[model samples]
Target: MSKKPAGETLYVILGLLFIAVIGLRTISTPELWTHLAQGQHNAPISFLASDSAVNTTWLYDKLAYLMWSIGKAPLLILLNIVGLVGAFVLLLRVSEKWGGALSQGFALLIAGHLMFQMIDVGPEVCMMLFIALFLYLLTTQKSPAVLFGALIPLQILWTNLHGSFLFGPILAGLVAAQAAQQAKPSGGRKKNQTNLSGTLGLLAIALLVATLINPSFIKLHGQVIAGIQSPAPVYHSSLFIEYFQIPALKPLILFTMILGAGGLITLKKRLPLTLTAIAVFGAFLVWTSPYHAMLFAILSLPFIVLSLTAISEYIHSSLEQMLGGKAKLVPGIMGGVLVLLFIASIIPAATGCAY
Candidate 1:
């Protein structure tokens, strides 16, 4: 690996530290308890195992079984903790591709918000990781054809791990759509950008096909949609606060509120198409139910942060222009409030103060 760059290295270390603190701060047994005990009488392949086994996500079950067997703890805290670090790294890198340099203020806001989300380690934890990772892979791909191929393995694995795998291709298709728009058709020889964008639609199709390779097959796709579209809540009432139902308030909702404000204010300007779509998808999930708010928060971060940063600059510059240097003292006073909120919100996690 290449030597670590200076500025990014520290933030990465801090990110890992934040995850570690959160992971260790709260320890809960995930639902691997019964699965491990029940599977002892059967083979590992879940297909011939149990007709009543709702946990067809055998890939994760096996991993969970391994960890639970050895450690006897229904916890993948370390794994999920590391996965959180990787997810953010992948997210920011991909988001940076569209948003330019992320401001430190926005970075803190994102990190602090996620500390709460990371405290619970379960199937959704890895789901979040692969969601970010899938987008990152698609974004980083140099060739369009290879991009589709790369998603196959991930999509297959993701399908076996969590029901949220359905969104992988949807998100990828959205990104591909944006790429197609960016790559306006032209006969010019130097139209690499256009060529790359054109292939994303194809990639989306391939990803769709790859998702079928999972053991659950086509039923998984239909089943997930049915669950999501079910009139009654798919997640039970006694689960986490996020899974309660519609009209629930989660911490991530606060970020989306900011994101909505920033997105609307900046609508007249030339923002990214893909970013806007991602934000829209996030908002839809939030509106549909609170359970998907985590996905929205992850998707909307760069957009919200970048927009707020721009807004801050606009406000400061406008004030300076209007007041003719008389407004120079405003930031010093206001900056303190922002800083205090930052520390209150984010610093404790970094320092391992759990509460």
Candidate 2:
């Protein structure tokens, strides 16, 4: 077996730091306490019986109740920590598969930003984990049925956890559409595309059904849609954070968007359709919700790393031709310096600097 390199070790360390930042926020925030109190206060049988109409995502509520009953603070903290770690691990695996040390480091940094967004308590964290899993399955598995079947439960859980359940189908459908369009001209390609699309459609429908499995039934869906359509209070508030904007023009946001665009432009021919699909879907999500900006970062990181690698290789080859191999160290040093600058710019100097 090959040994892990020093750069990979640095990536792991950065990933851990990311988790630590998120964990600190998770443990310190008063929001979890309110959520816990709400869950525990409504744990009575009579409460459920009387107020079923108001209870959306009763399954998630039940889980929160369980956590509160066990050891409120510890349980909630553990859940967030585990979920954050799981997200990082999945991202690392995906990036390692797609690129290498550079991809892994980029994935770690992007996932860190995601954790920093404080998605630990809500269904968004679970959705992110499932999304990571879905990406893994789609990339590694050859059989579309197997991947689709596996995703059904994730979809169900997503529906129960957050209104973002729709994102799963939207994401999966986009990828399926891309796959279908990119299918080969052979008869087998058509069959595969049809099956893939059908499976994704079925899973989406099953998820919708699962949403109805709760007591609120259709009301839950109505509430979710209403929530999405409703304007966020933050949009009107004095806080002008870039993530809350409909179309963020922040420097970091523009940089990531440019990086994603550059990746597509540079490696459109070399990348797999599935990878492109993930990038495009993530980009769309970022366009739709500033909350998904970190997701865009995560999805684009591997592509950018791969693109940079390709560019580095190209530059090295070109320089070799120009200088007869005497200038190899120049490209290597330049790449290393650029990577360092990238890392420095992204990393917060202090906790107060995070904002």
Candidate 3:
């Protein structure tokens, strides 16, 4: 493998630092105590006279408990840092693959800011890591051994880790559909496309099956679905602002609208269908509860980068046509605006005002 350029390495390190600057902090979530308490039961499934309390996050709780045993809350905080940083790194690497440095950096910073509040000792943090890993596998890995070996096991662990294990099969299915939609039977490429589509389809099915490996088996699905569909009373209370409905003109919502516009403007070039699907799914999550804003943030991140790239290229080309020599100035100004936006979004957290 060829060595990465020194500049690229420095860029990556800076990106990691940006994520950590926003992500690193002391754990303050009350849910951590509940998770640790439940973890002490030593059972993934519990039978009760009234209802079976299927522990969807049994593995996470167990691991959290193990960390707590070793070094108490400090170790759990370390695990949270490692998991969140790892997830952001995977996302940044994937974003770099498909977009310019400016777009990817902006996307990562926005995502980190949105996810910052979620940085705590909980299953949701673990879910963030798994989501990034699954996205990495879907986008970058094509080898059968790696895809199946990694994805199937990932689903199993994810099922036992969090209720969002359903995302594995959902994302895989979308990828398979995207492949099938793009495939055309013609020459040597036809066989390759067919195999790729078929492999991804099988992978989706395998991932779905893997979710049943948890102690609750098929019943786990019902439990998780019900949990998601059930509205928590906290959503309606005033204790947290995350559950509040986002204003239409909020900066993040406007950014999302811009991404949608970018996708529409670049329709001829064709954005990935899977991205559009995931973005829509993310919006649905936010609609259900603003507490899931991080879901929208991370899920829409790759698509946001791609949309920004397409929009940037279109603007550059259009500007070059109108003002051949001065086109670069416009994009440079836009880049500066993005940096300002990032700084503004993170200022509250960075200065400890958010805490």
Candidate 4:
């Protein structure tokens, strides 16, 4: 195996920090007690029976039942730890493939925010791990057929695990739409247009069919529709929490959103299709549900890093011309110092004194 780079080291450090904070919160809080109560009320058989038994996803309850059956808290804790670590690794791999070290670091920071919510013994944690894996495969794989084929089973599992599974197909449809829009007309023959249209059509059909593979089928779909219509009370009751809003005042959320916006403004000249798809998806997630605030933050890192690199290149070229030589390293050093200070401040806040 090749040696890890400095950037990868930084990501690992940050990832460990995230795990530690989440683990501490998971062990110390009353969140697990609530989940246990919910689990007892739902029961394991409800997953295979009917949606009338529980308000939450069947898959999550099943997993909790299995853990509880072990007759030990240690086993449940172990499984949760494993899932959390899996999510971190998947996030690192996806970010590394999309952007290099700096982007990976940003992804880890965003993952830290997610870990806070995920520690509460909820279905969203499992859904996030699967979502990360899906993104990793989508970004790194070359064959659309292979990727979508593999994604079918994952979608079924996701449907059982969390209601947020609906986002998977929605995301794929958005990507297909982006691809279709970006396709150019080939010399009046419309060859490119035809091919793009066909691909998008196939993707749409596959996504639709994938949802049917779940055991609940239409019931699952109906539950999702109902949830959307009714809205969760947590969002209404906890408006003061950062997780309940777009985090317009929070430094990290504001920074990530600005980065995503900047990417769309500047990098559209180069990676127009990718940046446009990201912008649309990120904006939709932020606008539609407060629960998805961390998803937007996690997904925006790659685009932000790409945009910053382009801006840095432009600046370096302009300075080289004006100076007739190399410029000083003051800016880079200052930027690094600022980043360190930001991390220092954020990490402590994440890992509270109770932890």
> Which candidate tops TM-score?
3
> Distance (Å) between predicted and true CA of 261, model 2?
1.1
Reference-based lDDT, residue 249, model 1: 56
Clashing pairs in 4: none
Name the top lDDT candidate.
3
Regions of model 1 farther than 4 Å from truth: 1-16, 29-56, 72-75, 98-119, 185-191, 231-255, 267-269, 322-342, 346-355
Off by over 4 Å in 4: 1-4, 11-16, 19-24, 27-56, 71-78, 81-85, 95-98, 110-119, 178-200, 235-251, 272-275, 284-290, 314-351
Assess the local accuracy of residue 323 in candidate 1 as a C-alpha lDDT between 0 and 100.
Answer: 91
Expressed as tens digits, the lDDT of each residue in 50-83 for candidate 4 is 5343344655765676688775576676676677
Name the better of 1 and 2 by TM-score: 1
Model 4 residue 259 CA deviation in Å: 2.0
Which parts of model 2 have CA positions greater than 4 angstroms off?
1-6, 26-30, 43-57, 114-121, 187-201, 235-249, 268-289, 298-355
Ranking by lDDT: 3, 1, 2, 4
Estimate every model's Cα lDDT from 0 to 1.
Answer: 0.63, 0.59, 0.74, 0.59
Q: Write the per-residue lDDT of candidate 2 for residues 1-355, one digit (tens) a residue.
A: 4877775566566655555555544445454554555566755323456643344445565687787688866776678667756765665666665566654555455545533543446545566666667666655565656765777777777777765567566656656666666667787778877777676666656655655655566877777777658723322334555555433334555565666665666553556655666677777766666666556655655565665555555566778889986875774465365467445634652344555
Question: In model 2, what is the error at residue 71, expressed in angstroms?
Answer: 3.5
Task: List, residue by residue over 1-355, the lDDT tens digit for candidate 1.
Answer: 3664554454444544544455553454445444454345434434564544344456776776687667755355667667766776777777664343324335545544644643465666777788788778876776655675667888888888887887787877777666666664556633766566667766778778887887767877776777666733535545565554333355456655665576568544666776677777777776677656566656766666566656666676889889987878765554455456555655665565534
Worst 10 residues of 4 by lDDT: 244-253
Candidate 1 yields a Cα-based lDDT of 0.63
Give candidate 3's whole-model lDDT: 0.74
Instruction: For each candidate, give its TM-score against the true structure.
Output: 0.76, 0.74, 0.86, 0.73
